[model samples]
Target: MQDIENKSAPTLDQILSLEKQVWTALVEGNAQADRALLTPDFLGVYPSGFANRDDHVGQFADAPTMKEYELSDIRLRVLSADVVLLSYRADYLRPDTETWEAMLISSLWERRHDVWINSFSQDTPLDQV
Candidate 1:
């Protein structure tokens, strides 16, 4: 039996929790958690390259490159019962260097099967532009 929580829509706190989980998984190199959060058809156009959900979760889990994936000034607005938008500045310490790097990140979220998942995202270097 599936023990699912009965909720009408995602609350702001719940959305934040989902985001926190993803960031936590990234920092700890836990790809399994990431896989659970991401939709199977997730796709992204990152500065590094065109990546899919499997690419990110698998690589982050296996190599463990990214560190300290922190989100600040997080603002979320509900677009609809099933959609939400989030904006925040993300900071991270590179594994190679102990320097804090940050970027402006905007993420779109969608509720599916009573779960919140990141549908799309675009990150721009905060210092550059």
Candidate 2:
């Protein structure tokens, strides 16, 4: 854990890279890695409603998987010296799905005890036009 404030705040690229790593962990069903990236009190908002950290990580309990994923239009907003908001569009295919699904996602990362962890997240399904 590096102190971002003692150093300099992470750049957009770095944050985006971290975000991608989380997605990769999900796809690979690496619950431990995913846990490291998220805060203990993390809250996720989805079409199914709210999910806590355990709820999120528990999804990987039974050979969780993803077929493929693509991220685009990522944007980062600095909420404060220690908080950053990242928003992006994701196109992905789930394990049993042949067609791809798209969604707009926003995540909030907060620097705590020298480590950045995702504190909150929300996903909105994108309607096909």
Candidate 3:
């Protein structure tokens, strides 16, 4: 639904803002916000397995999945006029945990109806070794 006819790539800050919204949703246990950030056919690849949009949001059924998070070493690439790939290192704490975990994430976002929607993501856990 993006004005594909007049396509334009989003700035690094714009995509970063959108990605932060997703992280904020996780920390806040905001299913609605999480769902809104992802496309209906969103695909997520994780250490556990593949997850759809619903599966991603389902973690909040009981409580927030994350307590806090920080994204760093961010990088963005314009894949097309209306698509971008954002990659970064994320350090986060889980609910009730004092320990921190880290992962490398690559997220694919597409422009739709003038809005950026996350279409895909893959998380690679940092080796504890």
Candidate 4:
């Protein structure tokens, strides 16, 4: 028998490309792109509290916390045929405190029909240097 996890692992190139689109849409604050990718029932809970798809889509507009989006060092793991997990780093410029910040982020991805959508995510701001 074969190993279940590695049976259909996503190639690094494919993961990079798809994950790049997600990050690009994030930095751009493109709600249209998010709407296309995020499931309507999506829920995201930051270290602070809970946010629905609307809140996640409007991260900059509704909250004064995040001011910028920067992504790096993304790693992907195949959880199953329909689910994938990613861990990475992000930079958030917190306007409230006039601070530049870094964070470790993990996101849950779900493949629907022919597309991958971010169903959930959480982030922890890394300590400043």
Worst 10 residues of 3 by lDDT: 1-10
Candidate 2 TM-score, C-alpha based: 0.91
TM-scores, each model vs. reference? 0.82, 0.91, 0.94, 0.72
lDDT of 2 at 118: 95
lDDT of 4: 0.72
Candidate 2 lDDT over residue span 12-116, tens digit each? 988888898888988899999888899998999999999999988888998756768999998999888788999999999998889999999999988898688
Those runs of model 4 whose alpha carbons end farther than 4 Å from true positions after fitting are: 1-9, 60-70, 92-99
Winner by TM-score? 3
Of 2 and 3, the candidate ranking higher by TM-score: 3
Q: Evaluate residue 97 in candidate 1 and report its C-alpha lDDT on the 0 to 100 scale.
A: 82
Q: The CA-based lDDT of model 2 is what? A: 0.89
- Model 4 clashing residue pairs (backbone): none
lDDT of 4 by residue, 1-129 (tens): 855545455565665666566666666656667667778888887877988888777764643334566778878888887688888898767545656678898878877755677788887878887
Q: Is candidate 1 or candidate 3 better by TM-score?
A: 3
For all candidates in order, the CA lDDT equals 0.77, 0.89, 0.95, 0.72
Of 1 and 4, the candidate ahead on TM-score is 1
**Residue 12 in candidate 2, Cα distance off native in Å:** 0.9
Q: How far in Å is the alpha carbon of 79 misplaced in model 3?
A: 0.5
